[model samples]
Target: METPALEVQLQTLPSSPGVYQYYDKNQKILYVGKAKNLKKRVTSYFTKRHDSHRIGVMVKKIKEIKHIVVESETDALLLENNLIKKHQPRFNVMLKDDKTYPWICIKNERFPRVFPTRKLVKDGSEYYGPFTSFKTVNTLLDLIKGLYKLRTCNYDLSEEKIRNGKYKVCLEYHLGNCKGPCEAKQPEAEYNSNIEAIRQIVKGNFKESLQQFREQMKQHAEKMEFEDAQRIKNKIDVLENYQAKSTVVNPKITNVDVFSIVSDEGYGYVNFLQLSHGAIIRSHTIEMKKKLDETDEELLELAITEIRQRFSSKSKEIYVPFKVDAGEDVKVTIPKLGDKKKIVELSQRNAKYYRQERFKQMKIVDPDRHVKRIMAQMKEDLRLQVAPTHIECFDNSNIQGTNPVAACVVFKNGKPSKKDYRKFNIKTVEGPDDFASMEEVVFRRYKRLLNEGEDLPQLVIVDGGKGQLSSGVKALEALGLRGKIAIIGIAKRLEEIFYPGDSIPLYLDKKSETLKIIQQLRNEAHRFGITFHRNKRSKSALNTELEEISGIGEKTVIELLKQFRSVKRIKEASEKELAEVIGVSKAAIIYKYYKSKKET
Candidate 1:
């Protein structure tokens, strides 16, 4: 078999964590993205239909797949961010934030000052965070200040400065906010211990700070210093609340990856969440086409491997919705309780939402794929040997036992084919007999198709329950087509589907596409049948009115109707006007008959 040009490149993609870049034919970088498995992510661009027109266009313009494999997901994220900044790929999200995000800088100097700065200096200073917003930086700074008073001044509290007596106790010392470290009133070792505790808090470890505060609270209480004890108690409350909010999930459940899967008949969606210190650092969802009817476990295993490798996940543990073999080097946990389970559930919700979003996009972008999925689903739901690509639905229209008729609506590829629709005038069936009418119409429809060597429908639907279905089955049997073509009936009440020789009806889901199409077919048949029946009744009433006239036969009635169009118009016509359409002798009979009736 001849291989596609890009197939070789895609098939050889490294299933390891990496950052992939797409370039246009002109060698201009179009987009940059990070993946744990390069092959899976790159292949998705070619294999899956994107709901995003921009992404779709970008994919079409891609001339080459260039990737840089990394060691871990964090490395990939940093690499992707750096590449996006360096190259400014057209398809990447254009971040308008030129101003550097705030970071808590513990300045590298004597009596290091802890403060927020938008600039990073590689001067041996310990920087804690690059907060997304200034407010977050401020919150952390305020929390640190409240817990332990650090110096706000930029003065260097070195031994020479203290010996020279260059500085005195400041207002901060008087206010008890600082230990007066500028004037050597505070011991360096004691101040350094406080700095170490602050370092732990900034690193998102609150146990040390909380434990020290609890001991202080107990010491003050032992001394009967109630006010001091209560003050310490308040600080502990603030620390506890801050820690509670910061660790949204269990702090113990750190450095873990969560995976969940949601799927339909044709495609599967998988969501991956990368967490650090109980916080989600990265989230991604990918769409995968199911070629071999893979099970959930199989798809999830495949997704986990691809995503982990693409992102270069080094996390020893992972949380999943179900148990799966994720290599012997990694531990796969199906979280059943607490924060672990909740994260897994959250992953599932993300997968479901992604699937729903893709569905909406596919409906508008690739309607053919949507239709095919629906057809495949219906074929399975109906348990038919083949999809009902060409369907014929029969509905009998008999009102008050007059002008009984039936309509057969044709649906090709799940849509009404009005050109192939047919109407039947009940010939052999007696008045108001729906079963007999259905039998006559179904037999005539198939018998003529067979006689003319035309293709018969894949499925036949009668708009009724068991009785009407049996009638249709009998007609198909007489025509030697009982098992050749699949047939069923739908009843108006309760929207139930009935199969021939089956007592119980099959009730499909209310929101199922299969049921929706069936309902559309049944409704179309009824509408078409009713319309034909109304026209037949109206024509019959008009013809009968003229045929009742003395000496007026069927041919003469038709002749007058062909010209005057209605009985009222024929009655208003003069003998001369009537003669124009039916000749003199026939015109005289019609004219005389109406005139005598008016006189009476």
Candidate 2:
């Protein structure tokens, strides 16, 4: 509902490109948008019905409209972006994790000092980044230090001062770390040339420095100055090595900005890659919280404008995953195939990884909400009538029909409830029968829960395909609990998930939360069952081996086995060692029996 004042104000808007801002009754900015025709764009908000609920709400809240007429659509775009960033309008896609990254600064002085800084001073000095990480800035600085002999002093290296002998060479000069520009020991021409090369290297253009070094090396080699040539070669190797690690694509793809976006329900992650000479010189991901169910194109367009301004990018061409309006001055390319497309994909991957990492951090910060979301997602994915707040998965493990065992792993609210985990010896199943083992375990688990009036799992997972699932279903039917609980089977190969009566399996996306939780349950059950089976097999083998010895009673056997851990270890023990462990009488019998058996 536009106010009478706003209606009159909107009627006066120019039919030209500009930015428009919407203000609520309190005069605070509610939204900022750009338009090719300010009058038409502003009037359309009142005339047309918005499909998005957020936009509808924003429209109703608008009380006043303000317009800034610009020279062109590009100007309007820039102004809109600036206003959004400045005011952070309520209806704008706002960057949530907006923090200024560090940059390497070359101070404006006679001999410029280089270091990392977060501030952008507008003197004659040069600043390199807004680098994604301080570690990256430090690494570049360290590499520069290793390659060049630059003065660290703050002294004014004027000709008059040097002629007057106002400064002396310092320890940095003696240590070969500095060329002593303060004392005129290093010529300004030589030092400035190094600075120029540093500038090129920082800009991701290594060809200049490499060419200079290569020419020097060639000149020295031609004059038979092998040591000087080797030094130059070493410098060239260092520069090339650093460049190789920094560059991601073809060196020919220079001076371009690449942008890619990934979005979910609530947020969009836009990743930016700045390329110079085919290397990724700068890469960053900006997270934007959606305010109006903004499309990826809208979010991406906003991000490109903001990022380009922040990083001072002047590339005439930009690469993006889709077509976008970045003003007519800047060519927007949607590369279909080849190296450009690969870089676009790489940017998208980075954005996705960042989004995943943010989700992990959110889970750590709000575990309860994370669990609830996971449960909801699982319910939707599995098509369950209710959220599977409590899930149980059963796995059977057997070794050649020896000491068969089954394990039931419990998950509560999408997390493992280790205290509720149970292991069962194969009481009803025999001879390595997985189906029967699964049936018996599932029945026993739920039947006991029913008898005790305890809660049954909302979902049951059997660690096998259709056969195992059928067996579980049969057990549920025996207890008259069929269709009361959701039962499914997971097969290891292809991760095919089978429902109780459905022949065709549901193949979950490999990256889905539903698949991850199911996989966790299956793996845990298998691990628990295998551990129990191994212990049972070891105990059975120990008991049989020791009991076969004629003089060893069960009590003595228990004591000896407890001490020595195995029958072979007990047999291998010395008479004195055995006596110290189990007493001389038992020790003597054990030692003599082993010795006679060995001789035989």
Candidate 3:
């Protein structure tokens, strides 16, 4: 169902290696593709049937066709990749790995300066990396600074300017940090040699620098200059130590880029490992969004070009999981065995791990996914058949056998359902019997739910150790719900979770989401119960004090409290103020009682 406009445009397409773009009715790019024969490739969409449903649907939506003729297939490939990244067409594989990473820049100047930068200036300067961390860049820079006496100032160290003595030596020169290159105190030949050594080190090559240092140390030792020899030996040790730490493969696998991709239905995670002199100095994972149902080969090919350009990778050979079209000039190897295969497998493992961590982070950041994950985790942790979408936690609050109360806090989907919370006065349990109080409250809660025909909670949590948990289990048994509901107890000290009929407790990891949710529930229940208990205790104490006043009846006490709110406020009130609240005679009695009590 190609439109008339698209058919005319397709007919005019040149028989050349180029990039083709498909557009919808509104002139929005639907897909970007590269082909050796642009005419044949663009026509195949209309002439042949696509097996992929996504491709079939995308073809039907095309309203116009656009193309850019290139000189070669390599040019088409690079152009297609750039277009995909820029426009992010609906039916193109788009690499979402555009995060700006730090790079070590070697500035192009009379006296070159080297520093870490996040931007690429395109000023004929060489950029080394898009390093995974600033710490790595800083460590390498520190190592270079220690081994080289380079200038730290930003002066225009031109030959004429240095000859004219336009700049003076700074504190860095006095501290032995710099060789005063700006004042021409250090020879350009010597400074250039240090720069060359730095370049070798940055490229993960230590042999040249180590050899020079070793030779210097030997000559110094032969001349009986032990201190200089020791200093050179220390420098060599530092270089070797750093090289050893960075090396992860055989020394023969030099100047090669390793790439491995792990893809899902929507996105692909591609891991890149840069090896120089058999050392993996750079490792990064790039995530790409799938526009069409692109195969791993297609996604990876696009990613290889994008990554190489972004990181300024100039490796002539690349070790990939599969053969990729990265131009005829670049050698692509699909390793079958040995260290190369091992490194490829390692890169694949890193991609897989990166994908898993990314999915986990997405779940945590997304509210719906977060709830679903937590609920599923809770179900598994508690050994429940179904996810605990609805959960209730009980805590008993009592102070020395008085004002006994229990609170139940509800959670729906790992979040507190505060409106569904319930509080119970300890009617059946007397004194400070926490176990009995827990039993009574659990029984009352589920019994009411059973009578009201309300849905039962998927899980029940008791905020205590085994004794309280056993008591709660007994209540469930009495209600014929011993096995119907999942119940567990959490201890205060270690946060151990105890199941009924099992003495052993389940200790979740400290950082586990399930443990955090359970802790939230337990803390909420305790807080709710304590708040209710405090209110009851305060009311009881207030009533008791009022009753201590002679001839002050319960009705009068109620009126005074209703008006004054508290005994302290009542005590602070004047006789006329109290009379306005209660009757004049009762107000006089209350005022005198508080005055005499204060005097005593």
TM-score of each: 0.50, 0.66, 0.60
Question: Per-residue lDDT tens digits of candidate 1, residues 5-57?
Answer: 56777888899988899888799999887776888888888888754456677
- Model 3 TM-score relative to the real fold: 0.60
Which candidate ranks first by lDDT, i.e. highest?
A: 2
- Candidate lDDT values, in order: 0.82, 0.89, 0.88
Model 2 off-target regions past 4 Å?
A: 1-15, 37-53, 369-600
In angstroms, how far off is 413's CA in candidate 2? 5.9
- Using TM-score as the measure, name the better of candidate 1 and candidate 2: 2
lDDT, candidate 3, residue 562? 89
lDDT of 2 by residue, 115-207 (tens): 889998999899988788999998888888877888887888888999899999999899989988887788888988999989988998888
- Candidate 3 lowest-lDDT run of ten: 373-382
Clashes of each: 11, 2, 0
Q: State the local distance difference test value for candidate 3.
A: 0.88
Candidate 3, 283-399: lDDT as tens digits = 989898776667899888888888888778889999998878988778999999999999999999999899889878887788686566567557656678788999999999998
lDDT score for residue 281 of model 3: 86
Clashing residue pairs found in predicted model 2: 250-278, 251-277
